[model samples]
Target: MAKKWDLFEGYLKCDPNIKAAEVVTDYVENYRSQAISEEVQPIIDRLEKAKADYFNSLFDLYEKEAEYMRIDRKVKDIAGVNYYIKPVVDFSDINLINEPEIVGAQVLTTRLFPTAVKREKYSYEEGAKA
Candidate 1:
């Protein structure tokens, strides 16, 4: 890390356009500015990049959503005749005691993908609902 700072300092000093000596006079001043800049600049750059990426990703998602909805509608139309999407809850992995009562009461449902076996039996010969 120090070596990186040294290399950057050397580069700045060698640059004819910059007044590197004014900014980096003493060891403490040089070390502090470099450390501060090193820590801060990357974070700022990362946040900027992330913001831009987020908007781009959002645009991508928006473009795909209409197609996805169309496909989903087709699937629901086909599979939804005999079966409706059922919500299942599993508390096996959860630390129920540590969590709030309201949290346990909240229901999470899978409306998109079916992950259930219907209790009612469907038979072609019988043509029954049971």
Candidate 2:
């Protein structure tokens, strides 16, 4: 799956006027700002805790309820991105954990596109005169 950064890179490549390095730097900075913001920090913490609890419960044979609790938790990414976390089942022969699925991420591209240029239209006579 193509990431948001990859899309930004492609956008920069399509527009010769845009500097790739500058745009990438700005994008990274924007991501960092959002990651550190108060609104997103708690979500990050909760995900970390969930992952830890899930693993700890998985090792302990009697912690089935805890494992289920971890699975029930809906952990979203910092930018409100939702990715699938495969639930580990107790079945030995059956492998329920599949490949990591990347759902989607919210991209902030307010300044990515350049301003539209006005084009002049001319009739056949106007073109002939020109």
| TM-score of each prediction | 0.35, 0.27
Tell me the whole-model lDDT of each prediction, alpha carbons only: 0.52, 0.49
Superposition error at 81 for model 1 (Å): 4.3
Question: Which numbered prediction scores highest in lDDT against the true structure?
Answer: 1
In terms of lDDT, the poorest run of 10 residues in model 1 is 106-115
Candidate topping TM-score: 1
Kindly list the per-residue Cα lDDT of model 2 for residues 20-110, writing each as its tens digit. Answer: 6866786687745654553356546755986788667556734654566564454423224456544354345443322321122211333
Q: After superposing candidate 1, which stretches have Cα over 4 Å from the reference?
A: 1-36, 84-130
Model 1 error, position 74 (Å): 2.0
Angstrom error at residue 94, model 1: 19
The residue-level lDDT of candidate 2 at 84 comes to 56
Error of 1 at 24 (Å): 14
